[model samples]
Target: MNPFDRRPTYFFGVYHWRERLRRIGASLSLFGAAVVVGRRGGRLRRLLAALVGVTALVRAGTTARRLLSPVPWALDRPKYDALASLLPLGDVDRALDVGCGSGRSLVGLAPHLPSSTHVVGLDVFDDRVILGNGPQLARRNGARAGIDVSPAAGDASRLPFSDDAFDVVTACRVAHDVPETRRDALFDELRRVCAEDGTVGLLELPITPEGVSDHEAYWRRCLGDAGLSVERVATVERPGFSDEPYVAIAATPTA
Candidate 1:
């Protein structure tokens, strides 16, 4: 694969240098305030300042790392690869990626499916959260990967597709972001669009401290409430970011 070919101009190819610099400056100011509080304030004030300082430092460090190296950004490839492998794609004819940012997951899963398979990615692009033109960037990324993907602007909670429209449906790191009250609606939409025998693959960050405990029950309940049955669950460990573990859940519509 040509590193320069088909790459999205805004997604990974362009760095948000100005935004990162602003964050760095803010973090430095917070650190300076922490030092002043520690020297002249009460014990409680010092403790609060210390907490804020630590958070600021961590944010600055992560932002700096992202700016200095491409490895952190490239990690999405392996993450999507793992997600695609966990889903049943051998005989898939039509697939959809909900909340597909820059079409990375769709492109990554394309190679695993039959050449004739049709893949579509839907996302409600918010300029504040999503960098650049999402649908266009997704198309460019798909072209670079030699996959033909249809990218569209849509919401997960209210998918525009008719019932039983896709053979495989997947979402990466999107469910938890939905408000607690609306999460069920999102899964309900996923179940509605998925064919009876089709699989719904969800990749999410661990919600529990140990990374595997009660989270299983929580997801099972969520899927069940949405009229889906959990088939399998697996935890994927990201190479560079060990503290953040990804959980992939495969579910099927209930009878």
Candidate 2:
């Protein structure tokens, strides 16, 4: 069996359904306008209506297709598996995944750890983007995968764990979501919870010019300011998304 062939069973979160419905509604509205305008409008008006309707229909179809297949989200199994591989799982007794959405990264990392290793996942599960009981789904998915993962609702900037509580800490595509005012706090929490020599793995998409200006430089500064030494940085690209690439950074505490 292929290691990355597994399909994600819990992809239809609240946000997913919401987006699907929004698209479908927009498509229907556009089609209705096209029908009404075509009945009594001029040639130019009919052409414009048809174009708008067709465009909306296409967008609706595309959104539906994205939800159906795990391509952009769950299908990137290799990336999660790779991030997990970067950790020292055998030596890690306690692992923490910050912003662990649906336990995808945890499920990928758990198989590599020792049976005695305790894995915990933390997320606010605020449903700001993807709606659903994130923590609940994560727990269910972890159990089905035969991995013992404890999922809980919590803030990333203010971690509940004590200092030096975890041997391994990972945050995938979470840094960008943190507000600028609390970004430093989030990194500090990561450093506080990580052991003296523990590893910190981060996987994030390149900061777009419309977003953060410079992706690499921004992360380097963010990590460096947090007193973490970036040991390595690698890029992962998935075609059809964008020309820009995704970046994964591995760092260790300097203090």
Candidate 3:
């Protein structure tokens, strides 16, 4: 999705500007200082550079900070990345990536969706979704990738799709933002739109205490409440990234 003034907060805490700003400012400052000191090149410059050594030391510090920074640069996470690896890409039909940001996941993983599959990215932030180019590019990129991606504005607590309208439904780190009472409704909506054998993937970054609860058991309880059964639950921890543990929750309709 596109950017917005009143963007609904992301549960993953990716939008926290304070930490992000610190990292960005540090990196840029280091870069700028290095450029300033590196301009005067000479043998004596080397001696002066040795005295200050602003560029190398500062650049190294920034690089290390970026790797360790718990910043969510794109709202993209392992859940989407892992699911993309597992998806039966060909012609994905009505494949929805809930909370799709700027279409990063869609662009990377959509190629694998079936030719018949239409990738729909839904987000509460209409501005980001519009700027995301998800819906527009679905058609533009669909012909080449054999998969279509559409963008829409919808509430995760209650999606607008009809019963059995989708073959694969994916929600990423979105549940953490919804009230506990409302999650069941969201799961139900996800179930209602899924085909009989369709997959419902809940991708989450555990931030809150509830989000960090036993991943498998949580999916069972949540998906089970929606009359869906957990088919697979994979918990993955990516090193040098992701402060929260992630899960790829694959479920299927029980009824």
Best by TM-score: 2
Please report, as a residue range, the 10-residue window in candidate 1 with the lowest summed lDDT. 7-16
lDDT of 3 by residue, 234-255 (tens): 7677565545467677788896
Compose the digit string of candidate 1's lDDT tens values, residues 125-199: 654444453688777776666667788788889999999999999988788778777888999999999999899
The per-model lDDT (C-alpha) reads 0.77, 0.77, 0.63
Question: Where is model 1 more than 4 Å wrong at Cα?
Answer: 1-21, 25-62, 66-73, 208-213, 240-244
Which of the predicted structures, 1 or 2, would earn the higher lDDT when compared with the native? Answer: 1
**Residue 213 of candidate 1: its Cα lDDT?**
69
Candidate 3 ranges with C-alpha deviation above 4 Å: 1-81, 85-91, 126-147, 208-212, 241-244
Predict model 2's lDDT versus the native: 0.77
- RMSD (Å) per prediction: 6.2, 3.6, 10.0
CA error at residue 89 for candidate 1, angstroms: 1.0
lDDT preference between candidates 2 and 3, better one: 2
